[model samples]
Target chain A: MNKIIFYNIFRFIVLVFIQVVLLKNISLYNLNMPLLYILFIFLLPFNTPNWLLFFLSFTIGLTVDIFSDTLGLNAAACTIMAFLRVFYISITVQSERLETEVTPNLSTMGFRWFFFYTLLITFLHHFFLFFLEVFDFTAIINILIRATLSTLFTVFLIFTAEFLVYRKKVR
Target chain B: MNNLWRFISKYNALFLFIIFFVTSIILFIRNNDFQRVSTLNTSNQVVGVFYSKVNNVIKYIHLDTVNKELVAENMLLRNQLKASHFNDSVVVNTVTDTINRVQYQYIAAEVINKSVNSRNNYITINRGSKHGIQKGMGVICPTGVVGIVWNVSPDFATIQSVLHQDTKITSSIEGTPYFGPLIWDGENSQIATLTDIPNQINLKKGTKISTSGLSVTFPKGIAVGTVLKAGVKGGGSFLNISVKLATNFYALQYVYVVKNIFATEQQDLENLNKTQGNE
Candidate 1:
């Protein structure tokens, strides 16, 4: 169990490095949102304590923020969404409690609920990040436009990561 | 005491929402840009190494296109040389519009795999340390700006294309010195937009825009594209202009990765100026 936890932690750190270092440099429409690192937050155990969840989420976000230097915007967005994830799981699958560390997917929960849940939170996280980066209300439409486009790309990547990492054998 | 406890229990969700919102706001306020830039700088150094590898693999597949660009450039240079001898002052404008200025140099390279369909489009080039490429180098085609070099390996380099998300260049109009941020409009690849040009600056539809050398990534006067549309942004202090990029990345082949010999000195001087201003 300890080895598995360490491996997962190692994986999370590597993803954060790739997401911000490599993918952040790739921008389209002025949006280079990170998708690989979010998987770190996605993969935490189902019944992890709330305080631990907050701490892990903050640490993950703070680490990313350290590399990107956009303040703690990533940390804030990540924590809020991590908090909401509890609600998403409870609403989507009756057996969400059964799997202790299942990353989100259609195989575990039906496609419809999973899609909606991912879509909403991803949008929220991206929207918040972009606005916080731009940090100006003079162009509200520009903010929304950036948020919308970034959300779309981030969503595409979330699924791509899931497809790569998902395994039928949870063990 | 019982009434207060009950009230707190009943409204936990609302409290959570407020607490979360306030925290985000604090983070937003605290994340000033320059410090964040340094963090990006470090990651830029590390990840830049990885993409350089992918660039090599894809470049092998696109040799034909790269050769074509080189051949075309050689022909244009040949033509210009002939014209220069005929008329000592006014050379034929085949290779460049600016005669005698030597505003740019060429380092021929090949494009491997590039993504324009994604929100962030990055292009990988086949030249790296083996070919004298490094990070912060500017890339151009015979047409215009390709991208800025972000990472480098022994045999390959990766660039953040102008078409990528949040990638902005400082640029000025062909005949005027007005500067603004040239950015890609998310919806389309053919068109990128410029912002922060004061509204007083009149930009025409056909104005040629080029890099301003405001940032270390690109040198001044390298071709970027031509303005397609110009406008005064709504209730803003600047004119929002759209430019059509000269390089047809969709059919990109060989590119030139340009290096500025004195880039390190220039950057240090610029930083010193900024620090002095703060005091």
Candidate 2:
């Protein structure tokens, strides 16, 4: 338990640092920015309390907002994403599987499950974030294009990170 | 009461989600006002320091390009020197030497953080109120206009980039009396739209666009962009003039925050005129 706590703290700092310092600069044609920090929320233990999960997601989002000068935008999107994560996990993962795996990742959950999870979450987050940032129906098409492109880009980066850390037969 | 408590406990996650979501939305709305949530932004000390430190390392990689831009700007300044020009008319002594009083002051700053991908883009500079950087000051790079100062902290300031949706720059075309407000379409950082110029005027491609000095923010005759296209859209009387912006936002590393020394005096006189007209 202590090890998990320490690991999460470390992950939080490293992911936020990489996000503000590194990923923030890597936009493709001023359209796609890979938000890899969301992966930190995805890697949290299954049994983590719901309130704690929401709080952590909010904190991380707000931290990104603070760095980027978009105070509430990321926090709102991240909170919605957290709610969806809880709903999705409850319907899909069985209680027995949660006890054994502890956390969901490409290694524990396999590529298929992880891919779908990352896709849905990333798409929803990007869609909400971009729309909120624009706040105009006239540019709906532009927002849609940006959101879709960024979602795909973020998911690709997440998968690459997962593959890098994947150990053979860790289970 | 017991049943209500039981219900609340069962759906605590939903309640928590609602609370957080609403709070975030409130913050988002409140954040639109620059002065309200000043500390919550990148201009705050901690985030400012961190970005500047990171930028210090990253700036080294762009040293080659930065040096070239600086050298080019130096050449332009050198060519404008009094020694570079020859006297065409007989020299005459005039007693009114006070006519050249300074109207604007510029503070040099390094761009620590910037984003062009977002619809409402912002730039964080390493100078702030401590360096006489104030809100509403105009920011410009060597190439062209950059943005307006939106918020200022002790050591950092956040600029609302010209790429933002709300950015409106009063600009005019060279060799033409027509002028209009220049705005970003929130699609391309390289392009902006100059609106309200009448369709009657025959605008050619590559006509230079410049600041008109109508506002207190920017000085007159500063290069903004060149006309890429001009035409009437949707039966509107005003011509839709697309401008290719002069500044390269992606490669931007340094900027100057312009302070109009006579801004308050100009604004006060305008306000006084309004009161007199009302009477």
Candidate 3:
């Protein structure tokens, strides 16, 4: 339990640093702004307490918001992501494996489950984020285009980061 | 008591989620922009220190570009001095002065941080309250108007950049008296929309657009942009004008904060007019 707490704390700082210091400056063809920091929420230990999960999600989002000068967009999206995550995991994870699964990382959840999990969460996060950011019905097409492109870019980056971290466990 | 504790434990997650989510939305909306901005912006102490440190390193990489802009601005200022347009029009009148006093002063600041991608983009500058920077001051680069200062800390300030959705500047064509509010379409950072020009007016393409001096923030006659293309909209009475903004926000580094000395007086007079009309 203590080890898990320490690991999450370390992950939070590293992910936020990578996000604000590095990824914030990168864009693909000036269209997609990849947000890989959402991976931190995705990789949290599967059994993290509900209250803790909500707090952690909000904190991580708020941290990104501060650096980017996006006041509450990230925070609101991440909080919604956390709320949905509970329902998602309950439906996706098999009952027996739920007890054994320590975390929702590439190594622990297996490739298929983790990939699908990340895909769904990343899509929803980007959708919510872009919608709130645009806040206009007239530009629905613009919002969709941005949300789709950014989600793909973010998912690709998240996959790369996960592969680099868990390469040995892949086999 | 036991039942109450059990009920709380059973639905604790829902309760917590609602609380956090609501708070996030409130902070997001920022009903009182002034109050929310000062405390939450990058200019605040702890966050400002961290971002400024990073900005110090990043600014070095763009040193050449910044220097070139400074050189260009210097040349422009020198040319204006040679021309000296301000005093040229001053009439020698003893009883009634015709030339209005310069109502704006400028404070130079460096753009330590900025984002053009977001819907409501903001730029942070090295100047703040300590440097006489204040909320509602206009920020402009050498090329054109950039934004309005929305928040200020002790040593840093944040600007609501022209790229933002909420930003609207009063502008008009150079030779015409017709004016409209310039707004961003949120489609391209370089392009902004000028609305409210009557359909009857023939707005030629490539006409120069400038600030109307109708707002307390921006002084009249600053170069805003040029009309890219314009036409009457389908079933609309106004011209659909596209303007190519002069300032390239992506490369913006140095900016000037325009302090309007008469802002308070103008606001007070306007308010007095409103109250008197109501009475």
Candidate 4:
């Protein structure tokens, strides 16, 4: 348990740094902005307490928010994503497997489950992020396109990072 | 009591989520106001110091571009000085010596952090109140207008870039007396919309757009952009003029904060006029 906590703490710091110092500068023809910090929320232990999940997600979002100079947009998006992850996991994973599953990663969860799970949560987070960031209904189409492109880019990066970190798939 | 406790514990996550989410939304909205001091903005000391340190190292990578821009600005300044010298000689021979009073002062600052991808963009500069930087001052690059100082701290300031939705600047087409408010449509950083231009005036493509100087924020003839396209709006007497902004926001490094000497006097007079009109 202590080892898992230590690993998560280190992961949080690394992801935040990468997102701020590296990813924030990358814009592919000004179409997509991949926000990879949300990956921290996605990789939490399977049976972590819900309240703790919400708190941790908010903290990470706020930290990113501070670096990006966006006061609350990230916090709102991450909190909702954390809240929704509970439902997303419950419906997808079997009850009997919940006890045995260590964490939802590229190695622990099958490719199909992990891919779809990351996609859905990332899409939701990006959509909400762009929505609040724009806060204007007149540019709905612009918001949608930006959200979709960013979601795709973020999910692709997350998948690549997961594969690189965990060499072999357990499932 | 037991039932209440059970319900609270059962739905703890939902309650926590709502609380956190609502607080964040409030902060987002409140921080958007020009008058508010955003805790997370780079103007804050901790954030400002970190960004400045990072920028100090990264700026070396763009030294060539920065040098070229500086050289161009230097040439322009030298030409202006030569013209001013010629005028001074003319004044020296005049019967009545006209004293030239300076109205605006420029405070140089370096951009430590900036964003162009978001709908509402902001740039953080290294100068702050300690350097005489203040909210409502105009920030301009060597080539064109950049933004307005929205918040200021002791050592840094945040500029609400013209790319933001709420930002509007008074601009006019070159060689024409007509003026309108320039606004960003949030689609592209390079393009902005100039509205409230009367439909009767024909604006040709490539016409120069510049600061109207109707407000104290900017002086007359400061380069803003050129007319990319112009068309009539659906049900208005105005033309929707598209302008290609002159400043490349992505490559912005150095800027000047324009301090209008008569801003307070102008604002006070306007307020007095409004009150008198109400009566």
**Which candidate gets the maximum lDDT versus the true structure?**
2
User: What is the Cα-based TM-score of model 2?
Assistant: 0.96
Ranking of all candidate structures by their DockQ, best first:
2, 4, 3, 1
Best by TM-score: 2
Q: Chain B alone, model 1: TM-score?
A: 0.68
**Residue-by-residue lDDT tens digits, candidate 2, A1-171:** 988889899999999999988898888777787898999899999988889999999999999999888889999999999998998898899877766527799988888898999899889999999989989898889888888999999999899988898977865
lDDT of each: 0.68, 0.90, 0.85, 0.88
Instruction: Report the first chain's TM-score for all candidates.
Output: 0.83, 0.96, 0.92, 0.95
Report each candidate's C-alpha RMSD, comma-separated, in the order given: 8.4, 1.9, 3.7, 2.4
lDDT of 1 by residue, A48-131 (tens): 655666667767776665444344667787877777776676665567464566545645655576578777888777776666
Model 3, span A1-171: residue lDDT tens: 888788878989988998888887776555688998998899887777889899999999998998888778899999999988877898988777566538778877787988788888888889899898878788788778888899889989888988897845542
Report the C-alpha lDDT of model 1 over B1-279, residue by residue, as the tens digit: 999989976755446555665775676564342223232322344434444455555456567766777788788788778555655566546565564655445578766546564444667666776788876778888777888876566665667788765578888887877888888855677889988887877666778999898876777887888989888777887888888887887777677887776677788998999999999
Better model by lDDT: candidate 1 vs candidate 2: 2
Cα TM-score per model: 0.57, 0.96, 0.90, 0.94
- C-alpha lDDT of residue B212 in model 2: 94
Query: Can you write out model 4's per-residue Cα lDDT over A52-89, one digit (the tens) per residue?
Result: 88989989998888877788889999999998898888
Runs of candidate 1 with Cα error greater than 4 angstroms are A2-40, A50-76, A86-116, A138-171, B1-46, B61-65, B82-141, B146-207, B210-221, B231-241, B248-279
